[model samples]
Target: MSLLEVRGVTKEFVTRGEGAMARKSVFTAVDKVSFEVALGETLSIVGESGSGKSTTARIAARLLDPIGGSVVFDGQDVTRARGKDLARFRNNVQVVFQDPFSSLNPRYTVERIVTAPLTYQGITPKGGRQAYAQELMERVGLNPDHCRRYPAQFSGGQAQRIGIARALAVNPKLVICDEAVSALDVSIQAQVLELLMRLQRESGFSYVFIAHDLAVVRQISQRVAVMNRGRIVELGTRDQVFGAPRDEYTKTLLAAVPRINPEWDAKRRQKEAT
Candidate 1:
């Protein structure tokens, strides 16, 4: 089942000329892009910088209103949902941004940050927020005792884990990860990817993972969407897109990524199978 569907969604920005000749011109950031994310599946949108992947993420998450087309979430057309309806929609979808530190408030304790969503929705956990926050911190591999620490006290990876914990507070149906791991070290990236996959297996939530790193996408995605010039040039299963790309742009992207070691790849596949 499709948890989220974006059909022919379009978003444009008006840019003005600098200085005396200030004239407005429309720049389309997302051009009639369309795709679907299945329940409990990870659909990765991969492309170079300025390829509209991030813009598409923002539109799907309802952070940016589309100029055209519709967004259907779990059978509801929430393209222009307002008031209580918008709040309801927000409770079911959350975003984890790229910069963990910037995303988290400097002054707020980890406990407060993790439970902010619940507070916004006026829902309290069975236990108090602090206890729930500690549980969430543990689930995301953080020290539960450190819940009182501020964001600045944690390392980059630990801060990202806190962000993950925050996203899970609402038990969202869909998580839009907009370059969520791009700022971390490669080792930290792998750990976070593993954590994300494990959480998906446990919670059965879908992810719209937007990233430029093909290697990371391969590790985490079941399906792939290739975007270029504000349009999706190709979309298919992981094997179909990576093994036998038909689009010229997709092929170029694959060609640019360094080949993974076959031995390592085989071991990884075996582990997945087990």
Candidate 2:
């Protein structure tokens, strides 16, 4: 069975008109979107901004409730799970936000920041929460000794590492990376991607990777879903979608990527052949 199933999920937002003269209107942000993420797989949702990819991620994480459709996790319906059930669901699923700087609390030390999930879930680690936090920091490539340092003390890449550590603190089955590497430098992005892939290999956790970057998506995703205007226009394996895109929007998105120089491409091809 799939680890996570989002069947015909939909979300809407209601906006009030400016002042008393304004009227209220409803806007559908996600329309009957459906996808599945298997255990230990990376399922990426790629789309331009405002395409509802983030909204879909939120719903999958159960951070937001969908007005329509159902979310099933490990064979349990979680669209309306409550109390202990909801809490357990949260522990099983975690999210790493796009902006690492804003996602972390500036006031808390790295130890506290990473251990917050454990604290909220009322879980005490085998040795100690701080010890577990340090272990996670090390696992994510951050210095375990720096656990006492605050968010302001780290660079963008380090801060993102902290966020990843936090998301993995509870040993979640699924991790929703909502543009988790977008804010870092290209080199840092590569490092973070490597770290995530390594962790996944070691931990066997699934990932719902949401991003607009097709190149990045191709790097980490086993399957890809392309969203446009609040719906998935194309869904397939990375090779199938990138090699032979069926949707026009998907083709346009692929074409939008900066083309490599002929000299560089030729060199790359020659190197591969050799």
Model 1 compared with the native: what TM-score? 0.99
- Please tell me which predicted candidate would have the highest lDDT against the true structure: 1
- Model 2 lowest lDDT segment of ten: 264-273
Candidate 2 per-residue C-alpha lDDT over 32-84 given as tens digits, one digit per residue, 9 for 90 to 100 = 99999999999999999999999999999998999999999999999999999
lDDT of 1 by residue, 35-115 (tens): 999999999999999999999999998999999999999999999999999999999999999999999999999999999
Candidate 1 — which pairs collide? none
Root-mean-square deviation per candidate: 0.8, 2.8
lDDT of 1: 0.96
lDDT for 205 in candidate 2 is 97
**Candidate 1 lDDT trough over 10 residues, lowest sum:** 15-24
